[model samples]
Target: MDFSDLNEALASESYDQIGEICDNLMLQAASEGVPFQDEWPYAVHLLGHIYVNDINSARFLWKKIPSGLKSSQPEISAAWKICQKLWTKDYGGVHESLREFDWSSQSQGIIIAFSERYRKRMFELLVSAYSTISIRDATVFLGMNEDDAINYAAVGGWTVEPNSGMLTVKKAAVAVEQKVDPGKLQRLTEYVFHLEH
Candidate 1:
């Protein structure tokens, strides 16, 4: 796999394209049949998790990692720890550990790709936990400025009151299952799939 393409994709901010490159690199590395001495595969896969917000997939990958490298590889180990914390909803631990450790080499492809997403996730967790929180508290937790925090909240579909600088999250409504009309369903099933606009 060419590292140059990864760098170009990062420079162009083509994140989805980067996932393809990461997957190809990982597959190529694994097919070589050598002991995994490099942290590249783990870094790419974990970042794939961060980009897509699929903790379950990340957990599965972590569990499948070779036992010898689980403790020996620093970056991979850290990524696993982060995934574990994410699985447990331990945002505080995730934040602290990310602060203490550096995943610099993975920056061009993965680390930079997921930085903002991670902050937004922390913001989401905070909003879900509290009925209402000040923009100040949110800024500190998410490591963003007041204006950015408010903007983030707004983009996240949260209610931010300008008067008091507080963001409020409305409790989500429960989903109700509705039964489909049997006649309509039968008619639809009789035909080939139709694309809905």
Candidate 2:
């Protein structure tokens, strides 16, 4: 129950900090000649990686887990299911896995936050990539039912065609101002002048 740094990170919803803390904890345990085995919350560590969409790190963590522990700990295996779905780009599968598994109280908050982030990210991708998308495809991408997808798209300022069931994606205009560093510019000019001379 005493998760130490992990509990602190979770309390602040600082998901990015979880990976570093878990890494340090593992290193500390190893240095102390302590057998971590299943004593550590491997599931939470794996989920932290997944929460940040760090699929490669999550996969690496999964590989590092002992087979015995992986088999014995249902939570660890369940967390890996989400990782596998994410790896395959199976968006619907990710939602399904999240729903199917009964996560512990400690892990539930991160899971919910991860789900919201994933959905928002997918919406941003849709806005940038599509002029129009079918309702069915949008549902799969958002991991929502048809009506829910339609409503969500509408809330995002997308127009849903009743007959066609195609959602018109509203792209937000992004104005990027190029910032030039004066010192860097002067240094570059000096280098160019020297080269020409």
Candidate 3:
């Protein structure tokens, strides 16, 4: 149980790699007919999947966990709660779940990372989808206070109407460009010549 690989993966914040390492470790342990000496890593493994927004894998991992371990460790349950909230598209619940959990040191970093990533993604979605939204809805979506949400919106180049408490979202422009590769074009010409002959 050296855990050097796990430590390195965590240090690099390669969450998908962290999930892979945990998956391999579990498989090896099961093949050897032994249980993990320290079961805490499973919590991190579950969180890693969630951090990457791989809800399907997270659900599978949750189902694979032993019932005793699920009951014994609150962290696992907390992670599952977040998973459930995410699965249901409950943004407010997801933030609340993250805030309510008293995470261990190993799990804390990923939790914070997940929160920021999710918030930024939601903000991007809002900027793309909405021309106008209320401050209250933005706060819930970003898990921030009114002031913070306003500031965040400002940073994103959105305008705030002080009298109406509304944010005027700036929709991002779509860039669609078509470029043909020279190699592919040459290959297509060669194929056409062969067909004609």
Candidate 4:
């Protein structure tokens, strides 16, 4: 399914339907005999970014008010509550690490250091989120095969052998493209959609 569609569903608060769709998607992946844990970090990190950045923006626009609005303002008051909770609880260290990293230089040391910190926290968030759902459910949510899921989870710099971490999403994507079947990835992507479509 498209990210926009998923975001729309989330905005509409159709969580139960979302859960069912995710469940079915996972079942399809399971049938392929792929494990699911690997992709968990990617999914969590993506979701965390969505909830924090995009959702917050939408909530702000929907509220139709400037920063002068009081906390009691109806527009974004509720949303701010949820966003604050997720930020403080779910993705606590990521923003901090991003600030700590020097983004100016394209040095190898800078890249490796940032990636190591980012991936570790991303993995931790993924594991925490995954524990809340069944393997079947997670597969559906990510729309990836069980194997792809595990591969994604097995991501992080430390998870791989030294000098093999790759250290960036672009690099990881290239590696997966080379190693994984394009057709399989497409199918997995499609599977993440709600069957109702």
Instruction: Spell out the clash pairs found in candidate 1.
Output: none
**Model 3, 124-181: lDDT tens per residue?**
9899779999999999999889999999999999999999989999887789898999
**Better candidate number, 3 or 4, judged by TM-score:** 3
**Candidate 4, after superposition: displacement of residue 33 in Å?**
60
Better of 3 and 4 by lDDT: 3
Q: For residues 1-197, could you state the per-residue lDDT of candidate 1 as single tens digits?
A: 44677677667776656656666666676798644445446655665665676777677677767777677767777777777776776655666656666775655445555666688667767756887898887876776678887887778777889898788865545699999999999888766455442
TM-score of each: 0.56, 0.85, 0.85, 0.21
User: Which scores higher on lDDT, 1 or 3?
Assistant: 3
User: Model 1 segments beyond 4 Å from truth?
Assistant: 1-11, 17-20, 24-40, 121-131, 134-197
Query: Model 1, residue 195: what's the lDDT?
Result: 41
**Candidate 4 weakest ten by summed lDDT:** 165-174
- Which ranges in model 3 have alpha carbons more than 4 Å from their true place? 37-40, 176-197
- Per-residue lDDT of model 2, residues 7-83, tens digit only: 98999888877877897888888888887876888898998889878889888888899999999999999999999
The clash count for each model shown is 0, 0, 0, 13
**Model 4 alpha-carbon miss at residue 43, Å:** 22
- Who is ahead in lDDT, 1 or 2? 2
Better of 2 and 4 by TM-score: 2
Candidate 2: what lDDT? 0.89
Please report, in order, the local distance difference test score of every candidate based on alpha carbons.
0.68, 0.89, 0.87, 0.40
